[model samples]
Target: MAETFAPVQPDNRMAAMSIVAATCFIALSTLFAKMLTTDALGPALSPFQVSHGRFVFALLFFVVGVAVIRPRLTRPHWGLHLARTGCGWGGVTLMFAAVAFIPMADATALSFTSPVFTLIFAVVLLGETVGWVRWAAVAVALTGAAVLLRPTPESFQPAALLALGAAVAMGTENIWIKKLTRREGRLQILLVNNLVGVVIASAALLAVGWQSPTSAQWGALAGVGLSMATAQSFYINGMARADASFVAPFIYGTLVFAALYDAVIFGAVPDWVSWLGAAIIVAGALLLAWREGRKRPTRLHPVAGVVK
Candidate 1:
């Protein structure tokens, strides 16, 4: 007799809930990042320092994970790992910097535009076709981004551009992670990712001035690392268990969490513009995602982390 194994079935409900949990963690990570950039916590730390803490602490978490599980190792693809970690670090750092200057709600909404950028990257990097439907979707998302930017002198914030840059970097990371997941196990991918990330972040941190983080600052930095690590775990699980599009819409909940966290912690309430711009971005992203899902049911996957 041959031994048989149980095949896992898709549980849409669990996957959706997992995405919600991931969003909550991602928003919490942003809140912790914002707290670090404020003097109220202690000495305000630069985004480079914040990013450094994220990679270092997140690496520790993974190291503990590896020691406990002792995952099977494979030949490392150092170049691909470097590219993915480089983009991830850049995206994380820019978003951290942006949140320091603008409301988290606004920053989260702007970062949501990354899916559109991913579509553009797919076209160039993978030779994927973009018909009129995708182009229109991209245009709608960009328009929403413009609304979020508030281009007028009284409302314009240069820091918002940093958020947009983060989106671009994340979109590019999406391309690289897609390639990586094809050949690597999740544990291997994540382990190599953070290992490379710490190296890159350390180099950047050294170039910038470093100060000993205060006790409160250390707490905030630890929060950023742990929350983000938790988020990446849940996000990967969710994507593994469901079709990407089926769970992708649930990610918009990050904006809601960000706004709620902002209100409760920072007392920064999102006005009509924030709501409208966020609504528009979500609409366009959903449209684009669903359209692609119909065309290619099993191929789509979200970026490695929730919103990072």
Candidate 2:
């Protein structure tokens, strides 16, 4: 008798729900960061201070999670982990800097450029072949980004540039993460990511002079931490169950959630032009995701390989 194995089936419904949950949690984290840094709010925090709190609080939550789960701690890919850590930290720092100055919707829209950057990097660095349709989609996405940026003396802000920088760094980090996922468990990756973040953020906080958060601010910080951890876990769970292409489009939900949060919390509703640009960006991203999903393995023809 031959041994049989269970067939693997993808739970797309669960994956979609997980991605939605992750987007909501991420939006909540961003909302907390915004509130904490608003000048009108008592004890308004600096960007660096907010970044430090996010990582520190997130680390504590992860530590508790690791203790409860008892996942494997040892991994052989320290170099990759270090590179990912640096990229993740750079992305986070830049994003927080942007959030300190820009509206939430604009910042979120800018960050959506990461997928476009990732596509370019895949073609250039990984030598992947992309069809002209995908290339055209990339061009459209770039145009959308330019529309949002509107490079004029009055329209162009340094914070927008920082958001783009954050996207690039995050895109690169995600590439490394894809490689790591081939060999490492999700728990291991999360542990290293949070641990590195905590260490680097602590050092930076010391260099810049740490400010003690008020009791209310502490609650906001905790919200940031809790949301970050929850979002990461939900995203990982979703990605594990569904194809990357299927899950990628759902991640755009972050933009919607961000806009809603901005409207509710800051009373800052996006104008018509911003909405139009965001729609274009979302269209381009969905096109790219559709292309990715259509990729199929080429089959060898029986007659082609035979010697006549």
Best by lDDT: 1
Q: Report the Cα lDDT for residue 92, model 2.
A: 76
Candidate 1 structure quality by residue, lDDT tens digits, 228-253: 88887776666555544344345655
Global fold similarity of model 2 (TM-score): 0.73
> Where does candidate 1 have its weakest 10-residue lDDT segment?
1-10
lDDT agreement with native, every candidate? 0.71, 0.70
Lowest summed lDDT window (length 10), candidate 2:
1-10
TM-score of each: 0.72, 0.73
Q: Write the per-residue lDDT of candidate 2 for residues 1-308, one digit (tens) a residue.
A: 12222212345566667877998899899888888987545678876788778887878888888789886555448888888889988897787788778875477567777866766666665455656766666666656655654444432486789888998998777566655654566666777777888888888888889777888888898888889888988876665544443454566567657767877777978788757766775686567556655655233233332212
- Enumerate residue pairs that collide in model 1: none
